[model samples]
Target: MHDRDQDIIVCRCEDLTLADIRALIQKGYRTLDEIRRISRCGMGPCQGRTCRALVQRELQASGINIKDQVPGVFRPPTKPVTLGSIAEGAGRRSDHA
Candidate 1:
């Protein structure tokens, strides 16, 4: 079945729709923490590093005060690096610039 309503694709990895988030907001789900808990927007391969800012903007548009908005939970590493780079050992040092 085709989705009649086209919403913004927030999390490509998790396939979260903007409508889903808006509905949550309409349901009195304010703040990033509440939104994440209900809609799971940032729970994806890239995590919130991808769409946290956009989500915050949308939340602000709804008249929610987000000044003290803290970031969502973070998982391991914080950076996704290639295994080959680690194995190489001889990573690029200085002098290139």
Candidate 2:
């Protein structure tokens, strides 16, 4: 592959390049979840919102059939949560007990 392609930033949140992902795939980290756990590619602020598709594309280019490959689960609170809300919820729960 060309240097430009390798240097392509797939996950900007983690500053990961395509080469980084390719290396992970070659090491048998084929699934998105596996790569995420090891390289922390999509575990960023976007939570794969931006990088999931890119990761899938990379996997496909590497000859992996991603049609059945389930992407990693993305939990809620996609944005930052304030500590005050957490404390308030905890207090309410304690009152019911």
Q: lDDT values of the candidates?
A: 0.73, 0.87
lDDT at 87, model 1: 54
Task: Find the candidate with the highest lDDT and give its number.
Answer: 2
Q: Which stretches of candidate 2 lie over 4 Å from their true place?
A: 88-97
lDDT of 1 by residue, 1-97 (tens): 1264245676676677777667778889888988877777776667788778878887998898789777666877567667898656545543343
- The estimated TM-scores of all candidates read 0.67, 0.80
List, residue by residue over 16-96, the lDDT tens digit for candidate 2.
988888889989999999999998888888788878898898899899999989867778886857889989999999999
lDDT (Cα) of model 1: 0.73
lDDT of 1 at 94: 35
Which portions of model 1 show Cα errors greater than 4 Å?
1-5, 79-97
The per-residue C-alpha lDDT of model 2 at residue 41 equals: 89
The count of residue-pair clashes in candidate 1 stands at 0
| Clash pairs detected, candidate 1 | none
